[model samples]
Every structure is written in C-alpha cells, then in structure tokens.
Target: MFAVDTSPRSRTRQYSTSSSSSTRSMAQRDSMDIDSAALLDIQRALDIARNTEGDLDHSVEKYLEEQLTGVWNRLESRPNTYVLSKDEFAIFNYFVGRYQDSKVAEKAIARFWSSYQDTGSS
Candidate 1:
C-alpha cells in the first residue's frame, strides 16, 4: 500500500542522513577534480617551460594572427567615426581569449563600439 501526505501546507524538510552523506561525497569529488585540474595546469606549464623564448613568442603571434583576422575584418567594416589605433592588438587578444570564437568576438567588438557611442566620451 502507498500512503500520501495530505498536509494543508508545505513545510521545509530536513536533509536525510543518506542524502547528507551523498552531499559530502559530492563535495569531496569536486575538490578532487579541482586538485587534478591544478596538477594538469602545472604539467602544461612545465611543458611550456621546455620551449625556447623565440618558439613561445612565435607560437603566440601565430595564434593571435589566426584568431584576430576575422575580428580585424569586422572592425574594418565599421563606419569610420572613431580614430582607432592600428597597433592596438591587445584588445583583440583580450576579446578573443575571453570568447575564443570569431563570431562572438565580432559581436563583442560591436557592443563595445555601441557602448562607446552611448557614453559620448572622446
């Protein structure tokens, strides 16, 4: 036979012992995952350290150029209102790193320009 609660009002229920134990187990697993992730990051850092400075710089430049091409094209299509700095590649790098997608980075650049216009600040 199945019995149902027929209370007139709903009330907060306390956590059961099993559920509490499960919650604790979940927290432990989460911490373990974080630890493993940190270890992986350290390994990657060591691998990068083995590379020479020129190799690292070349790789970074290659990545930035590959990622920023679409972003540059998008900026090129915009109206010539703001005097943009042609050498300002850092902003493109920042947005690309933040989104890691050309389309999304283009959209973010559009929004940035929109906000700049709205602010009316030179």
Candidate 2:
C-alpha cells in the first residue's frame, strides 16, 4: 500500500526553503549594476555642468544641477538602497536653499568631501 507523508515539520521546512530563495533573489536584484543609459544621462549632466561658464550663481546652479543628477543616478543604480538618508537630505536641502553662490558651492563641496571621509572610514 502507498502512504502519504503529512508532517508539520515537512511543511515548515518547505516554507523556509521557499522564503530563503525569495530573499536571495531580492538581494540579487537590489545589488544589480547601474544601467548604461543611466550612466550616460549622468555623464551628459556632468558634461553640461563642466562646460558652463559664468558668474558664481551660474556656476553654483550648474554644479548643484549636476550633483542632484548624480544623487538620482546613484539611487537608480541601487533601487533598494537610499543614496541619501532623511537627515542627509535635510542637510543638503538646507545648504542648497541657503547657499546659491559660488563660494557657498565651494564650501558645500568641501563639507561633502569631509562627510564622505567620515562615512568611508567608519
């Protein structure tokens, strides 16, 4: 006679296996590389910013435009990862609102580098 196995442990084991597989697939998708089209868009934005020449306000606007594009690109590259946390976004927005000149842009860039170093080291 044929018999069927109906154990609780077997059902639990099957569920766990399926859950783990799904998690792995999600992780793989999250870590996928940046798309080429996105990279090209970023490069084009950077090129526009780099080629622009004018007074301080013009330069800062250009630089900020490029920086914003970069942040967006990074976010796109890792859809599951945030390029800037809430706090970082607040700080960046405040800086952008308050500093619309070339000198401010320079200071902001310096601050960005310092913050990058701090985060990178830890």
Candidate 3:
C-alpha cells in the first residue's frame, strides 16, 4: 500500500521563490523603463532645439541677439532673479576660458554640437 501526503511546506517554498523572482523582474523592468524615458526626453529636447535652428555656430549671432537679450530683459525686469546656477556658471566660464574671442567660441561651440550628434548617431 502507498500513501500520498500534502503539506503547506511545499506551497510555502514555491510561493517564496516565485515572489522573490517576481520582485526582481519588476525592479529590472522599472530600471529599463526609466532609462528609456530619459533617453526619449533628451531626444525630444534635441529635436526641438534643432528645429528652432539652435545650431551653435550658424545661429550664434541670432541666438545671442535674441535669446540673450530676452534673458537680460527678464532679469532686469525681475530685479531679484536668481544668480547663475553652478552649471550656468560652468558653461560661461568654459566659453570664456576656451576662446578669447567671442566669435571663436561661437564657432567652436557649433562644431562641438555637430560633432556630438555625429558621434552619437553612429
């Protein structure tokens, strides 16, 4: 004669393993989703900038004339506008340090932008 026995032990073990694996899978998926979303946002911002003719060298003069003027005007109007953040300061310093001439800096920034896209697309 043979007897079959059923116990909670088997079910508990199975449940634990499944739950742990599910959690791991969910975490992995979440990470991947976040990465994809970030990439999409960056792509969208670049597209808008590109569409707006924000190329560094080609549009530098216009950008400087328009955007900078707008920014200055806003700051002047606001009076209490926040000072340049760290990143803004860094960018300003980089341009100032890299090229003595504003024209040269404009050209270099444009070239850098073009090269960045070229390398990234590949």
- The per-model lDDT (C-alpha) reads 0.38, 0.38, 0.33
TM-score of 3: 0.23
Model 2, global lDDT: 0.38
**Alpha-carbon TM-score of each model against the true structure:** 0.25, 0.27, 0.23
Superposed by TM-score, candidate 3 places the C-alpha of residue 40 at a distance from the truth, in angstroms, of 18
Candidate 1 matches the true fold with a TM-score of 0.25
Clashing pairs in 3: none
lDDT-superior candidate, 2 or 3? 2
Candidate 3, residue 119: lDDT: 59
> How displaced is residue 4 in candidate 3, in Å?
71
lDDT of 1 by residue, 1-122 (tens): 11122436322111111122343333233323343223222222223323323233233334444434544554556533322332223436444555565564555456555754765776
| lDDT by residue (tens digit), candidate 3, 1-122 | 11112323221100001122343333233323343223222222223333442222222223333433333343344333323322222333333553455553444345445654665798
Query: What are the root-mean-square deviations of the candidates from the true structure over C-alphas?
Result: 20.2, 21.9, 25.4
Model 1: per-residue Cα lDDT at residue 71: 42
Task: State the local distance difference test value for candidate 3.
Answer: 0.33
